[model samples]
Target: MKTKVNEISIKYQGNFKISQAPKISSSVNAAELLYNTWNKDQIGLQETFKVVLLNNANKVKGIFEVSTGGITGTLVDLRILFAVILKSLSCSVILAHYVK
Candidate 1:
């Protein structure tokens, strides 16, 4: 059997960054911020969660999905988050959200 690496093509849009948002110094940073915020929005959803690791430049080094759960499910583990960051050399991490 042969295994292939999957590439998740990240889409970029001018709108991905907001010019009016003075908090971000650059568009790339802004998009990364939003990507992280939305990714971790666990409200009104199942237990599905994602973790986005960013390099020192704030570029997305990797995006990992730990678990996909439901309202009645147990909480997700924090070790998963640490594991991803530990293996990879990420400057920072942003939690997308947990399903519950």
Candidate 2:
């Protein structure tokens, strides 16, 4: 008899074309993108850690929020973080955190 096992797969889907994705040339550009995408209301209310996934050309692949915590601090599990980066096939990453 054969036993059934769980199957797992990783997938990434982006609505926008990769060519249209904004490229990150400098810290300022990355900051601007992060600021614009961040939730306005929660900007000053809590602490959150986010990862900016980038392609080989330094173009943004997507942003992933790793965790959101209390006003003082947030936790970032390396396993989960690496998992996201790996699954998304990101060549580089810029990490950002919001503090209040």
Candidate 3:
């Protein structure tokens, strides 16, 4: 008899076309992109960590929030971080954190 097992799947979805995604050539470009995507209301209230997922061409795949915490700090799990990068099939990544 075969035992029941859980099946796992990973997916990445983007609302916009890849060609329309902005390309990142410099740290400034990435900061601008991340800044634009950040939630303005939460910028000062808490600490949050995010990852900017990029394609081989350095175009954005998406931004994934790794964790959120109190005003002072947040935690980032390497396992979860890698899982998101692997699942999204990102070629490279930029890490960002916000703190007031």
Candidate 4:
């Protein structure tokens, strides 16, 4: 006789709210949006990978920091990014990275 093994499960906490304000119509708009969220003083100190989730209306559904690291670059776990996208039910995504 053998015991059963538990399957892997994914869970999302907190809130995933969809916003209608300030839709991303172009690359400039997207850049402005991301720039506003980044910290000015820390932008040149390290690297941070981020993912912006967009709904069908091109509105921002969510922003997730995929990873952070030293001055050069950061390691991103694709699984986490995909999980966030799946949980947010986003139709599109913008991947951005800040480097020193």
Give the alpha carbon lDDT tens digit for every residue of 1-100 in model 2.
9999975445556688899999999999999999998899999998989999999999998899999998889999999999889888889999999896
Score each candidate by Cα lDDT.
0.59, 0.91, 0.90, 0.83
Candidate 4's TM-score: 0.79
Q: So what's the TM-score on candidate 2?
A: 0.88
Pairs of residues clashing in candidate 3: none
What's the CA RMSD for each of the models?
Answer: 7.6, 2.0, 1.7, 3.6
lDDT of 4: 0.83
Residue-by-residue lDDT tens digits, candidate 4, 1-100: 9999975544434464545356899999999999998888888898999998888899876678889898877899999888888877889999999885
Q: What local lDDT score does residue 56 receive in model 2, on the 0 to 100 scale?
A: 98
What is residue 75's positional error in candidate 3, in angstroms?
A: 0.7
Candidate 4 residue 85 C-alpha distance from true site, Å: 0.6
Off by over 4 Å in 4: 1-19
Model 1 per-residue lDDT tens digits across residues 1-100: 9999975334333354432333434657655664555544565565566766666656655566666677766456877667667777668776655433
Descending-TM-score candidate ranking: 2, 3, 4, 1
Whose TM-score is higher: candidate 2's or candidate 4's? 2
User: Against the hidden reference, what TM-scores do the models get?
Assistant: 0.50, 0.88, 0.88, 0.79
Worst 10 residues of 3 by lDDT: 6-15
